[model samples]
Target: MTDHNQAIRDDIAFMRSLAEAGRQAPLKGGSILMAAGLIYAACAFATWFAASYPVSPLFMPTLWFGGTGLFFVALFALRRRMGAKTETNRAAGLIWAGAGWALFVIVLSLMLMGYRANGWWIMAAICPIVLATYGAAWTVAGILTQAGWMRGVGFGAFAMALVCAWYGLEVRTLFLIYGVSLLGLVALPGYLAMRQAQRAAA
Candidate 1:
């Protein structure tokens, strides 16, 4: 019985050590958020321009897909440059990655189901989905890091999502709001995280 108890205690200690190590790991440089924000903003602008001008429908798809491709390529390069991730970092990455994939699947499914029939509703739904993803990831990160500010950010994201849903704004206006949200929620938080890491290192 004593031996078993000792083993359990040892396991607990090991887990604690791992958690501590994770907490000490260097923060993400926020490149992903910055890149995503810029890409999203650019896409929004391009979409608006296409609608305002006599541009072909094909142009919008090309711009969006091309911009997405570029963003992924940049993300890959950034990850490679960052080298190996710690356990906590990997956990965080998985959360955001899963959210992104879910968003893609949701959007694709909606498009496939004839979005033209309910274009306005579809557009409004997209914003909440995005904001929810951001909120979930940020909230989880905040819990892990014990960062009060991050929790506030996560709540703020959810609030924004609610506003988007309630207003059911037009696509062009929604895109503009989304761009601003990305800057505030993703880019700004990422910048702060990087700065915090730098200060810790210094």
Candidate 2:
């Protein structure tokens, strides 16, 4: 009986240590997310301005493509600076990366469909989809970290998606609102993550 109790205690202690280590692991790739949010925010703003005030036919697409390109460049640079990742960070990174790829494929497909359909009404759906994707990502992160604030942010993102859809009839309004949403949903959380990582390193 004594030996069995000791074994059970050792197993519990081992699980506790694993949980503690996971809690302490700092999430990396915040800078990449922050840069993506800021870059796309600028793109959305520029596209809004172009729509409000007429610009060259090629201007909006060019701006968006350039912004995406810039983000990739920034991603490469920031990723190189990152040190070795813990299992926690690796899991978080995979989730975000998958979300990013999903968004990329969805957005491009929408763009192509819009072009083929010869109607841009489909473009209005992009903001809501983007926000919802962010919501899912944040929700998963919250589950992994067991953080209430992250979960709140995730639910808040879902609400924001509905808000964007409500105002999505107008391209200009949608772009403006989405830019703000990116600031709050993507940029702010990313900044907070960066701060947390910095403090952890310290």
Best by TM-score: 2
Which lDDT tens digits does candidate 1 get at residues 146-172?
Answer: 577877989999998887677555666
**TM-score for candidate 1, residues paired by index:** 0.80
Off by over 4 Å in 1: 1-19, 115-121
What is the C-alpha lDDT profile of model 2 across 4-83, one tens digit per residue? 99999998886555445557775677788789889999998887888878678678678978998999999999999988
- How does model 1 fare in lDDT? 0.73
Global lDDT of each model?
A: 0.73, 0.84
Where does candidate 2 stray beyond 4 Å? 1-21
Tell me the lDDT of model 1 at 22.
53
The TM-score obtained by model 2 is 0.88
Error of 2 at 39 (Å): 0.6
